[model samples]
Target: MYLKLLPFFPGRVCTIQDPLAAAVSFDGTVSTVSDTSCSYSAVQDGYSYNPDSYVYVDFDAHPTVSGFVDRTEHVFKDTGADPVTCPADDIQGCSFGPVTDKPKEINDVGTLALTTQLGSLTFNAILGVNQITTLYTDDTLLIFAPVSKFDELGGLCGEYNGDPADDLTIRDETVTTDAAAFVTDWKTDPNCVSTPARSMLRYHDQTSLCSGVPQETVSGFEGMCQDIISPHMNITDLAKDECLQILCICNDRDIGACEASLEEWFTTLGIVDQRKKDPLDLAIELQSAFL
Candidate 1:
């Protein structure tokens, strides 16, 4: 399954980890999605692009998957060209920033309304949703979003305000209405619609949050069950470790891909542990419900 890079195609598999490092390096739902993020990579505003109508990346010009492309200065950037605004000193490689802002066409596997919203983190950070440079000063581009757009993803970073989710919340979430407006702003932004990386993550985040797989099928819980109910007592030790493992995978932003891994892990565990008299059923059930 090779994703052919287009236009000035850099030929590198668009990765989630780099974008994440530019944003937040924490290990949470968003972080996991960031690390495992890999999209086919596309030039958002390429040939045949329509600002009025929706356009998506495809081997063929008429793609079934719909997403927005970047409409910013470097909106029409090609691997062949330099970033329109980047200075040579700021970026070492090419005129542009080595094609970091992916095109929406490449990562629109999940049916989504592609936009540049960063996710609930942006709203939680209260970084002024509208690409406020002074506030979002990290080297890599900052994607600003709200939980409604991120839906399920918000829960990952948006907890009861005291848990690990709080670590990422730099601002006050008490202002939910403003955060909601941020989500709208990002979605309507022409620039965000152009970049695939930003838009793809936004879509996947919402898709996962909105349409998560059934709890029992998630691999994290399944693996936990296998570990805890194992023939040996040390299984308990292993079960404790799976929380991070599953959650970490979920953070990659590709819910479907992570869910696939979870399903596989669970299938293998179910087969291997079929014979064991599992005392961890209750615990596993609890974890599974959360997934």
Candidate 2:
């Protein structure tokens, strides 16, 4: 999706896609969240060294389904370290600068809490309902959804609408097997070009690692990770995929690290879920048992 400019705040806009999304501009304006779609905004505090920034949140009863946010974009007057081209300004756009930090992910058990660079965003969930109360924040941007929407949403967070069958739903509402095409379809702006997906082909070794994994190992992990949701594929299937990726990167001697990464994968799967308990607690327990 595209980041739409907010008229109330100059140089500030809300993303129409990723739930854990952020788009920044050079212009001076406070950040906030608008009721458009899956979006977030940040307000820059007057501090120079640590200007506490915060994103506004909505407190609707029938809450919108915003997936977990893991993506951020910043617009700079000029290109700097690791620049990604943007359609608005050919100079620079979609920078992951420290202006906004990643929000800490929670699970779908009880309350909603997402920690951002600026501060914390928290909200209490109503009992037996799919909505949350007004969000209380310290100085951060956070997103949440009802437990009823668990794995029932889509967008930049992946094709996780509770269906493990189709994870690559593009912007045109079509399913694509091609990774580049999938990324391209999510772009709300036509002039914008997707990042160099093809350029990273050389580093991909998961294909080889996918083979020879024990079925019991996969089933066991999947059984323990039932709470986590896989965005692009079935949790069972994703377990295998993550297994391959983890194996590709971690050596045999680094089995503990691999287990830890797997535990992280499980926790991350529920990061966007709006129920309650911290995914890390489950992750820690899973690690203790499996590792």
Q: Best candidate, lDDT-wise? A: 2
Q: Score each candidate by Cα lDDT.
A: 0.24, 0.28
Error of 2 at 174 (Å): 1.7
TM-score (C-alpha, index-matched) for candidate 2: 0.32
**What lDDT does candidate 1 reach at residue 202?**
22
Name model 1 segments beyond 4 Å from true.
Answer: 1-174, 177-180, 186-213, 219-256, 259-291
lDDT per residue for candidate 2 within 22-93, as digits (tens), equals: 221111111112223322222211112121222222211112333222223321111111211112111112
Please identify model 2 stretches exceeding 4 Å from their true place.
1-144, 147-153, 196-241, 249-291
RMSD of 2: 17.4
Give the candidate number with the greatest TM-score. Answer: 2
Q: What are the TM-scores, per candidate, against the unseen true structure?
A: 0.22, 0.32
